[model samples]
Target chain A: MTQLSIDQIQAGDELPTLSVDVTPTTVVLGALASRDWRPMHHDKDFAVNRNGTRDIFLNTPNQAAWFERYVTDWTGATGRLGKMQFRMRDSVFPGDTMVIRGKVTNVSTDDSGCAWADLDLAMTVNDKITTSCKARVAVPSGSGDNPWKRRGSDWQPNGPGNSNAKANGS
Target chain B: MIEIPNEVGDWIGQPRYEEDTEFDVERGYIHTTCSSVENGNPLFWDDKVANELTDGPIAPPTMLSVWFRPHHWAPGRKKQAQPLQIHFDLKEKLGLPEAIMTDNTMTFGEPVRPGDRLKTRQILRSVSEPKTTKLGQGRFWEIEVEYTNQRGEMVGIESYTGFGYRRGA
Candidate 1:
């Protein structure tokens, strides 16, 4: 995978969308792989009687992992996950399609000259957002060096140089 | 109207778990997670591609929760605490037995590599004042899980927010 250079990226640049069929297997496998063996994620009866959901649903950790994958897949090999935060609006149930889409909300270089992409992502189903997220990823400046190899990186979610600092309101 | 409990504040600023966690991060498990999510990124499983980045394949940041899962079923294994005990506790107090996640946030440090043994400590950072929303009557709480490697290096930190509420009064 090619690293996106500073010039190759810009605010509002929409990343390719990913659509996943949220099947019972999809929901259950995601839960088990994450070691989240919660009954709500696997047992339909428990989910219906105990949780009051339509069917066994995906767990929170499973959703968080998917958000990480969505962003990193866009950042390429030279990039590192900076920070990821999101709000869960609705439950992701089996048979729902989890369509993930993201855009470059901001781009900046930290003190060390590492390129960072601030992404705003929404995982939606049935025309409603199930989760909304903001993430930061340090990408290659296309300067031929890995950003993670820098002696130090000041890539905090709301650090001084981060363009989203004020927006993060931290 | 929602009534906030007094003990909810007692948990704030307190360590949630009794002990820390230490275990070797496994590659096979990493692969299982990647495949489960249909994440085919070579960064997670391809050492050849990883050599281009670091020493070897690294676990996906999404696998953060997988490391702490209790054994599926073991005769003598300590019963793991409820995933969201505080939320459940508060819900039971407010007559709201169902709780859901309002959001999740996490910050990663260096990449976690296969074979790297790591430890983690869980802390209850804060709990919100009782509030009423369209969903139900309850509160929101944040839990922070910090990870440290066998080398005593910080691996990553996960901050989670859970909203516990009953559907209606």
Candidate 2:
């Protein structure tokens, strides 16, 4: 388990990096997970012919996940995502290994002592930035207690509540 | 050449409204990829956790991207796309020589769970005349979409900036 305090977090703190090979299978499967039946997202030939795309590209949902991973992984289990924003600069296609990165750009505390941070984020493929954004994450305050932690009463360890639940099988 | 009137151009930029639109969130492979990329655990798919955690089936925070899964883009439109993307379909169908996605921004809020019927409203933000570029002059417009969930709670907002260029302009 990772431990972090808002008082320890400051602007310019580097968030962890997530490197993944963006494959067509993953992209296509993602569409299924969301029940998004848009053929262009899965069928490369159909997309190239019908949608004028060069090849299968990452959808908005995929980009959003990338942003979430960037924030939560560092903030720990209790860290809840508050707000996230991303701009698609280029297409992410099959066989592309993207390096998603972020850094703490600013940190502040609300009147209620909620530790809020601004993160500068980017996803790079082939050394090119394909997606970039600024995200805000709500962290536990300096008091060393996260009010949201107790709410995980329903969270089942090693169960579906964990985003890494599938990795166990793989 | 078909020269669209300046008034029509203005109209394209003019803000319009979209309301009472309902969409759903479901579980599928997209969740898997999202999980892998984000290092999420199985609980995201654990129906038990979802039902117990949020008092309903919860979708990933990114569910907004797929909220339109059960709905059509527009009632009578042939091509399908995000509501914001479809806003420019009229220009595309008219054989407009050039349109490029100029800018886009999305601000996310609450996580949209399954069983949450979302309503999205849109407003025309701004439209600008053809601005000179190295390639040629291009027209631009901006539109905003405000989304509210079934609880009449604000979920998120999206702003789309689109630009179209005349062929060889």
Candidate 3:
């Protein structure tokens, strides 16, 4: 597994532009996995005639999950998500390609061996930003130790302690 | 005219019991067909990278948006009342006004990897009064759902915003 130290990432460092296609099947599977029963996401005619939507757009939860994935993928197991905020701008249809872009805006280290980075994120389809967000992550300071040794190492079971684990060193 | 229910707010936030969600590696791959249709990029298609990010081939980034809702695939779960339709019908019964979709946004979280079972906790976030628009009388509301995996991890949050308008003469 490849891991980058929080220190290695700079304020201007750009996270990879990950892209995914949004399709009816994508929308349906997301809704199914999410238990979202709203018809506009799945119903074409309803969106076109009733909602005046160009096409079914990606839902908010799915967008949030993607943003999380983008950060986690970069931070690996050593980083914890602290806060995230984003706005849905344009509508994304099934056939549109969704691209995620992120830039490291701030980096700091606390008394503990935790490193923090604030990121500016945007998801665009066909050159239009459909979602823009900001997220803060707490990552291990590395303490000059090998990062690969700790891949998926710090993850605790989801509970009161889980949030604590991220807050501890960061 | 539809009669307004005295306790309309009570009905809005009634929590629907969450249902079980399951996923198989193959099923997850099959689910990615939507990504292909959307002209998805190779990042999602690369098996090695996907495994690194999700521990296995995961669904497309937006796969959950369309899949989790109670539908023909999961019949037992569908037995529960549909919230959107119920609200629509109730509004008519109460002679309440119409709603519309003004705008909405979503923030992505961790990748919903393959074989992850998620449970959705639904909530009625808020209902705002009619906002004056040039075309009509528009009212809006935000419906939010927090999705948690079997591990009790907050995988994502979904919020839907809708607006309603008065009929034209």
The candidate that achieves the highest lDDT relative to the unseen native structure: 1
Docking class of 3: incorrect
Top-TM-score candidate index: 1
Q: Provide the DockQ value for model 1.
A: 0.48
Candidate number with greatest DockQ: 1
TM-score of each: 0.88, 0.73, 0.59
Model with the higher TM-score, candidate 1 or 2:
1
Which window of 10 residues has the lowest lDDT sum in candidate 2 chain B?
B86-95
For model 2, the stretches where C-alpha displacement exceeds 4 angstroms are A1-3, A31-40, A43-54, A142-170, B1-23, B27-57, B69-82, B93-102, B131-138, B164-169
Ranked by TM-score from best down, the candidates are 1, 2, 3
Q: DockQ for each of the predicted structures, in order?
A: 0.48, 0.17, 0.17
Clashes in each model (backbone N, CA, C under 3 Å)? 0, 21, 44
TM-score of 1: 0.88
Judging by lDDT, tell me the better candidate of 1 and 3: 1
Q: Candidates' lDDT values, in order?
A: 0.73, 0.60, 0.57
Q: Which ten residues in a row have the lowest lDDT in candidate 3 chain B?
A: B34-43
> Which regions of candidate 1 fall more than 4 Å away from where they truly are?
A151-158, A161-170, B1-7, B83-96
